[model samples]
Target: MDTLNCIECFVRSAEAGSFAAAARRLGLTPAAVGKNVARLEAGLQVRLFQRSTRSLSLTEAGEHFLREAGGGLDILQVAMANLASRQGQPAGVLKVSMGVAFGRLYILPLLKEFLARYPDVQPDWRFDNRPVDLIAEGYDAAIGGGFELPPGVVARALAPAHRVLLASPNYLAARGVPQKPEDLSGHDGILIRSPQTGRIRSAMLRSGDGRETPLDLRARILLDDPEAACDVALMDFGIILVAMPHALPYLADGRLIRVLPDWYVDTGVISIHFAAQKQLPQKTRLFIDFVVEQFRLQGLDRRFSAR
Candidate 1:
C-alpha cells in the first residue's frame, strides 16, 4: 500500500480504537484496514498497537509517531489547499467546534460573509462549553482559548485576549466596587465552571507595584455558562470575571462596570487549532485563513486595551 494510504489508515484506526470501526468509516473491509496498519508497522519497524481479543491500544512508539506524523499531514494539507485555491474554487466540508458564547457573538455573524465568498464550501459547526478531542471527534478545526496543544495537533493564534473583572452598575452601586483584588473576597462573586473539567477558573491578580493577590472566593452562584453569569451580574447578583471581549459591549453601554482596573489578571488566548495531517482538503485551510483575517480586521485584541 502507498505510504499516504497507510498513514491515513493508522490515524483512522487509532482514533476509532478498532479496525472494524475504522474500516466502516473508510468504506473498506476490516481485513484491509488491518493490512494497511501492519504494513505501516513493518515500515517503521515498531509495534504500533497492543491488540487484545476485543480492543486495540496504541503503543508508546505509536503515540510518538502520531505526534510527528500528524504535523506533517497538516502541512501537506495546507500546501495542497493553497495549490487548489489557485486552480479553481475551494470545495469540501470544514467541521469546527467552539465555545457557545464566543461562537454566537463573533463567528456566527462572520459565517455569512465567509459563505458568500466561498459558496462551494460547506461548514459544520458545533458549539458548546466542553473541550473536545479534535482528532478523535474528526473535526477539521476548532476555535478556543489558547492552552498547551495536544498531541497530533497544531495551533495558531487568532487573537489576544484577557480576563476582566466586571459587575453591573446596579450591583456595584448596591454592594460597592472592589478597590483591590482582595476586596473581591468580601463581595458576592458569580463563578463560571468548566462542565468538561468541573473546575473553577482562577487567576492571580497583580497590582501595579508587582504585588500578587490570589483569589479563592466562594461563588454566590456557581454556573458553567458565561452568558448566564453575565446576566446574574447584571441583575445585581454579584461580580463576575470573564473574557474582555464578551464583556466589552456591556461595559461600553454602561450596563457593566470594570473593577480593579489597575490589576493584571491571567489572560487566555483565542486561537484556531487543527489536526496535523497530510493532503488537507482545500476548504479547511481557507476557513482558517478567513477566521484569522476576520479577527485582524475587527481588532479583536483591542477589546482588552483598557486593562
Candidate 2:
C-alpha cells in the first residue's frame, strides 16, 4: 500500500466529505478512493469516517487526524512542486480559473507570448464567472474580482472593477437620452444579476465630487451575464450597467457611450489569486509575473478605471 497516496485520498475525502467528491478532484475512481481510505483506516487501526449511502461524515478521530495532517500534506505538495520547478524546465500543467468575458477580452491575448516564453508549461485554463475553491479544485491560479480570500490563498490587485452605464446612439436618440439618474426611470433598463449572489445587482452611483445617488431604474430586461447585457445594449435594446473591461471595446469603437460619465459603480478591485506558499512552482510564479508585467505595460490599470 502506498502510504502517501492513501494519505492524499484521506485528506481530500475529509475535506470534500465524500470519496466521490475527492475522486473527482483527484482524477480517480470513487471505488479507488474508497479503497485507499479503507486501507488507511486499516493501517491506522481507526475508523475515520461515518459512511452511509447518502452521506459521508468524519469521525471525531478523523477530524483530529485532519487537523494534524492537512497542513503537513500541503507542505509536502508544495515542496514536491518546488522541487519539480528547480529541476531544469518547469514542465507541468498550469491550471487556472478566470471569468469568461474578462479572460477573453484581456488575458487570452497574452497566451501566445506566454507560450513562446515557457513552451514547457501547458495551460489548462477554465473560464467561468463563479468563484472557485482553488485548493479543492486544484487550480494553480485564478484571475477575477471579489473572491473571498480562503486559507492558503492570496490575491494580488490587478485593476479596479468599475461598472458604467452605457447606451447606443440609436437607443439614446429614440429614448430621448437620460440627463440624470432620475430620468432613467422611464427608459428601458438592462439590469444584470450578480453571479456570486444570484440576486439582481443594485448599486449607488458615485461621482468624482463625493455625491452619491441610487441607480433607480424600472427594469425592462434582466440578464445574468454581463456580455449578454453588453450585446443587448449594442443592438439598441436599452442601456446597461457593465464592468469597464466588458464595455471598453464598444466604447472605443463608438458602438456605445457612457450614459452617466461622471458617475460609476465601484465593485472593488480585480485580482489574480494563487496559493500563498513561500516557494511557488516556477511555472506559476513566471505566469503571475508575466501577467502583472503585461498589465503594467499596457496601462490596463488606468484603462480599466472608470473614474
Candidate 3:
C-alpha cells in the first residue's frame, strides 16, 4: 500500500470522525478509506480508532499522531501543489463554501470570468447558510462571516457585515414609517433567530457620530435565514433587520428601502476564509486574490457599510 495514501486516509478519518465522511471527501468508497486506515494501523501495530457501528473515535495514539502529523500533512500537500503548479496550469477541484444568497449575488457572477482565466481549475462550490467545518469538511475555502478562527485557518475581510433595517414601500405606506428607533414600538418585525444561540437577534443601531439607538420592535415573524427575511419584507409583511449584502439588490430595485439610513447594526465583517499555509495551492491563491480584487473594483467594502 502507498504509505502516503494510507496516511492521508488516516488523517482525514481522524478529522472527520468516520471513514464514510472521509471517503466522501477523498472521492473514495468507505471500504477503501477503512482499508487504507487498517493498513496504516497494521503497519504501525496499533489500534488508531475506537470504532463502533454508529461512531468512530480516535485512540490516544491516534490523537497524538494527529497532533504531530496534521500540520506536517498540510505543509506536505501545499509543497506538492506548489511543485505541481510548475509542471503546467494549476489544475484541480477547488471546493469552496459560501452563503447561497451572497454567493449568487456576488461570487457567482465572477465564475464565467474565472473559468475563462483559469480553465483547468474545476470549481466545486457549495452554497450553504449554516457555518461549515472548513478543514474537517474538506473545503478549500469558504466565504462568509461569524466563523471562529481555528489554529490553521485565516480570514481576509471582503466587506463590513453591517446590518440595516428594511421595509417595503407598501408596508411603510400602510403601517407608517418609523422616523426614530423609539417609534418602532407598534411595527411588526421580521427578526432572525440565531441558529447558534437559539435566541432572537437583537441590536443597537449606531450612527456616524457614535449615537446609539436600541432596536426594540415586535417580533411578529421569526426566521433563521436572512434571505428569507428579505423575501418576507418584500411581501410587505413587516420590517426586517438584515445584512446589507442581502438588502442591496432589493434596495437598488426600490422593492425595499432603508428604514433609518443613518443607523445600522455593526455585526462584523464578511470575509473570504481559507487555510493558513506557508504556500497555498496556486488555484486557491488565485481564487482568493480574484475575489478580493473584485470586491475592491466593485467597492463592496464601502457599499456594504451602514454609512
Per TM-score, the best of the predicted structures is 2
TM-score of each candidate structure, all chains considered together: 0.78, 0.94, 0.93
Cα lDDT of model 1 by residue, 1-307, tens digit: 2888888788888878999988876678989999999999999899999999989999999988888886676567566656656357786667799998889888999989999989877788999776677876678889887366788788788766567788888878887878777688888889988786778866777666778788755589998888888888888888888877678778878888888888656566778988766555678777888999988889875664435
Candidate order (TM-score):
2, 3, 1
Model 3 regions lying over 4 Å from their true place: 86-88
Go through the candidates in order and give the clash count of each. 7, 0, 0
Where is model 2 more than 4 Å wrong at Cα?
none
Find the 10 residues in a row with the least total lDDT in model 2: 82-91
lDDT, candidate 2, 136-193, per-residue tens: 8778999988546888799888899888999999999888878877888888988999
State the lDDT of candidate 3 residue by residue for 1-307, as single tens digits. 2988899999999888899989998999999999999999999999989999999999999999889887788788877876766356677889999989999989999999999988888899999887788888898899988557776789899988898999999999999988888888799999998877879966888988899988998989999989899989989999999888888999998999999787888878898889887778889999999999999998999989888
